[model samples]
Target: MTTKTFLKAGLIGALFSAVAAHSALAFPANMTTDGPTNPPVGHYEFCRSLPQECGSNPGSAAPGVLTREGWKKILEVNYEINQAVTPMTDKEIYGVEEHWAYPDKVGDCEDYVLLKRKRLIETGFSPADLLITVVLQPNGDGHAVLTVRTDRGDFVLDNMRNKVLLWSETEYTYLKRQSEQNSGRWVKLQDGRTVAVGSVSQ
Candidate 1:
């Protein structure tokens, strides 16, 4: 192409690059996963039971914006799920290996998050917004909770609390969480962020 045409093309390409970079940066460094790994076994089981929830619902998540209604839904789902499921240690329920699944009669922390995510998806909430996050509690125990991504900020829906709180407000140290792009894979949160997995503390 002519010199003028080449320069125009270059300018357009640079503009697109900047937009992509900004979008990437929009995801807080704390939120991006360290890398992607296989989906947990319990998630596999959950998919077998509720195939629809596990399957891709394209464009299901909201536009990264948390509205007044979205906030209300978060609180409602957290309280309802927390009250519905009876908390029990994995050893008592499944024994060994972090078992993450949807809670029916009883489940551990991850199970609570799974159920919350399922119900929220059913309620027309985007699966992308509802992420399963793993964190180290203050007492040096590993814990699982639902991390809801919103325009307002990342909020946590924990089995430990009926009231939803910002992820930063919680006592847990950030570790890893499911990637928003794909539910089957998980990524580490930040470097040197680690915690122990104690039996269901909540």
Candidate 2:
């Protein structure tokens, strides 16, 4: 599935890691099997940073120019090279699935974003720019999206697709920025159609 495809329904229940056909995969490389690892405590502009507010600093999650190490960090994903994430896959991370339930090689979309955000912070991206965006696919399906604010603009990291794409490059309409609201929870988008959150649409 395309990045937007999986994201539209909070997918990523499975991860297909292939070096050739699906080289770009794995995503955040979360800390534990339970779920995504949270960012360091020092990073939060305040407990009220995400959804509750835009954060004290505007450019927190923005990873503009990555250093050599930082680039490596940003690119690092959860892949066991030479090991089969699946029997058919050759490389570490092949790709990801969103809607499929009980995804052995996958997880929820939130996990992907959490891992990505954590790794970026370790590399040097400010915690502010990385916004957790809940959006609907062009078809009005549910999903989650991570927006990495850059000096140029925002780059979207998705589990469904491999390479990162700009926000505009993807078709999913922006529903609500995780850091924009005070409740720190998912919100509906105006002017655009509505989609379910955390659930797949038939």
Candidate 3:
């Protein structure tokens, strides 16, 4: 890896080294189930926009083990995309129903997470480690964030914040997430342990 990559990894490692120590309070492993499903239309469009990644093979690494280089790549992609993209809803940007796609100028939460995941995958972070996760905001609005699984636990990369945080710190109720093995697939991520944060039923 290059010097930049090494520095990025070191930064991420320093920022998230505590996660693994606190993993017991994080989302339970049983919450996620496995299955291949259809990709959302906006994700489909985004995939069409980048055919190379859409057709690429999945990563073979064990789920959630954070290497210094991989962790740095995740932080780099998350921070870069969060700073670069202006947040706007699908209605404002596309003028229609909920659409999840990569943004050129402005896009909503889902769009932010999509681009982050795509970039991380492109940067050689395992697709299995990077997941697109959905949650119910405190106000009951449906929201999306990128979940980077690590030995430290699942850290959330949100458009609203530049820092990568454990999912428990985000104040959003866990709903569902993309399957580890495939980008096109999704799985429900709720268990009896989940705390309701909003009135939204998704």
Let me know the TM-score candidate 2 reaches against the reference structure.
0.47
Report the lDDT of model 3 for residue 32: 51
User: Regarding TM-score, does 1 or 2 come out ahead?
Assistant: 1
The better-scoring model by TM-score among 1 and 3 is: 3
Best by lDDT: 3
Q: How big is the positional error of residue 169 in model 3, measured in Å on the Cα after superposition?
A: 2.7
Give the lowest summed-lDDT range of ten residues in model 3. Answer: 193-202
Residue 66 lDDT in model 3? 71
Return the top candidate by TM-score: 3
What lDDT score is found at residue 183 in candidate 1? 70
TM-score quality measure for candidate 3:
0.75
TM-score of each: 0.70, 0.47, 0.75
- Candidate achieving higher TM-score, 2 or 3: 3
- lDDT (tens digit, per residue) of candidate 3 on 26-115: 455323543444555566666677666554335634565677667667667777787788888778888887776668979888888878
What ordering of candidates by TM-score runs from best to worst?
3, 1, 2
Q: Compute the lDDT for candidate 3.
A: 0.68
Residue 146 shift from truth in candidate 2, angstroms: 1.0
- Per-residue lDDT over 120-200 for candidate 1, one digit per residue giving the tens place of the 0 to 100 score: 878778887788887777777778889988765577889997656656556787766777766765656652333423223
